[model samples]
Target: MIVAKQKPIEEIIEEVKDSKKLLILGCNECVTVCEAGGKKEVAVLASALRMYFMNKGQEITIDEHTLERQCDHEYLEEIRGNIDQYDAVLSLACGVGVQFMAEKYFNIPILPGVDTCFMGATEERGVWSERCQGCGKCVLAKTGGICPVSRCAKRLFNGPCGGSTKGHCEINKDVVCGWQLIIDRLKELGKLDDYETLAPIKDWSTERAGGPRKVVREDLQA
Candidate 1:
């Protein structure tokens, strides 16, 4: 899942305070799961902004809307007619959603209401930790399903660094050595022999090195 966090109210206030009318757009996807941008969050933020303006002896129109998703063209199209009524839209989705919204409505200002963090999983009720970097190539098969790209501090492809001590990462004692976890898993699976195999140099071009990435399934395309 993609993790995100709500921006400070003060920062959000600055983004749309000048507008006579604003729309607080929320998403019901990953941001909702993370409690950053959801139906409830949208209501809370909109109410806070309304209160802020009300205290100044001013009035502004702030509409609240929650979409099933802001990234998909089909979902975004739902607001095509209504979006123009607002001066600007504060999108409480991930960065991709905000950018996609802007691309769709080029003339309107689509502002981000949350800071997109990373692709991660919910560790507990309110804690989220990184899990995947979407490097284009997946190596979980050989690594015992643990992702070194996201878990390792250095994103090592071979093995743990010399600084690692007692299964702890060199960067921080609190962080477990990613390689250590991989090795242990491999051991449990009785596949320790795979560790002796030399890992080829990682092709970084498949990552951000080549710029924006895309996946198109020819068979899936209508």
Candidate 2:
């Protein structure tokens, strides 16, 4: 899942300082699971903004709403009629959701309420860790399901980079060496020999040389 953290209240207020009428939009997907941009967060932000404006003797009208997903055209269309009523929209979804709303509602200014952190998984109730960098080329087959691209601070293809000490990353004592984890996992599965093969140099041209990349599936095309 993509994890995110809420932007500070001061920063959020500054974005809509000129707007009297605002809409606080939330998502019911990934952000909800991370407790960053869910319905509850929307209400909290709306109330905080209202309080801030009130304390400053400025009257502001803030409305809140949560969509099943802001990235989908169908879900975004549901707000077509009412979105125009507000001067600006504060999207409490991930960066993708903010961009999608901006693209669909070209006339209104859309502001992000959260900082998209990383493509990661929940480690505990409040801990989220990075797991993938979306490098396009996947080499997990040889690493026993551990992703070195994101877990390793250096993103080494075949590594424990001599900097690792006592199974911990040199960059941070708290961080476990990504390669160590990979070795342990492979050893557990009786595939320790897999480490003998080094990965080929990544072809970045195929992964990201051009502008934005797009995947077209003729089978799914209408």
Candidate 3:
């Protein structure tokens, strides 16, 4: 899951200051799950924008819409006619959704209403923790489902590094040593022997090093 936070209302207001007509666009995917850009968030932002203008003795026309996914062309196409009526679009989705809208519309200024944080999971309602950096390589299989790349400050490929003390990471006393957790988990599963095998250096060239990645499945293509 991708976690993001809402941008400050002041910052959002400034972006559309000159526009009398505005569209507040939200997404029904990851941003929705995180509660940052769902239908409720869209209404909140639109209402706030309207209130701000009203307090200034100026009237602003603001429309709210939540798309199934702003990142997909099929979903975005539904707004083709509606978008033309707005002077600018204030996207409440993740950074990818904002950019996708800009790419599709071309003529309008698409502004982001949230800051993209990280690939994370909901620890509980209103709490999210970073889990993956999307480093292009996945080593969770060997790490007993613990990710050192994201949780360990050192990102040590084989480590608890020399810096770890007891079971805690040296960089932050609150953080558990990722490698220690991995070792303990594997031990419980009688797979501790897996630790002896050193993982090969990740070949980033096949991952993101080459540039934007894509997958084409002929069977899925109509």
Candidate 4:
């Protein structure tokens, strides 16, 4: 899942302070799972903004709206009727949703309310960790299902870097050595011999380094 963190209240206030009417938009997708930009968060932020302006002797029209997904055109279209009522939209979705809203509503100011983190999974209650880098290639089959690109401090593919000591990453003692985890998993699968087989030089062009990537599936499209 895509994880994100909310921006500070002060920064959010500053972004919409100049506007008389503000729309606090929330998304019910990944942000909801991360507890960053969901219906509940939208209400909290709207109330905070209202209180801030009220305390300043200002009267601002603050409204709250959450879409099933701001990233989808169908969901975003729900606001088409009254989108002009607000001076700007404070989107609590990820960066992608913010940009999508902007593109769909070219004249309106679509401001981001959260910083988009990486693709990750919940580690525990209130805790999340990075899992995949979307490298455009899958190596988990050869590496015992552990992602070296995202797990490794240096994105090493071969083996534990010299900097790793006792299965801990040199960057931080708390960080597990990605390669060490791979080795252990391979041993469990009786594929330890695969460790000696070197991974071919990675073609980074397949990643974001080349440009914005797109995958078109004619079968899935109308």
Candidate models: Cα lDDT each: 0.94, 0.92, 0.90, 0.94
lDDT of 4 by residue, 1-222 (tens): 889999999999889989999999999999999999999999999998999999999989999999999989999999999999889999999999999999999999999999999999999979999999999988899899999999999999899889999999999999999999999999999999989999999989878898999999999999
lDDT of 1 at 79: 97
- Cα RMSD to native, each candidate? 1.0, 1.1, 1.6, 0.9
Q: Evaluate model 1: give its TM-score.
A: 0.97
TM for every model, in the order presented, reads: 0.97, 0.97, 0.93, 0.97
Give the better candidate number (3 or 4) by TM-score. 4
What global local distance difference test value does model 2 have?
A: 0.92
- Extract clashing residue pairs from model 1: none
As a whole number from 0 to 100, the lDDT of residue 178 in candidate 4 is 94
Residue 155 lDDT, candidate 3, scale 0-100: 81
Query: Which residue window of length 10 is worst by lDDT in model 2?
Result: 203-212
TM-score of 2: 0.97
TM-score of 3: 0.93
Clashes of 2: 0
Per-residue lDDT for 113 in model 1?
A: 98
lDDT of 1 by residue, 1-222 (tens): 899999999999999889899999999999999999999999999999999999987779999999999999999999998888888999999999999999999999999999999999999999999999989899999898899898899999888889789999988899999999999999999999887777898898889998999988999999
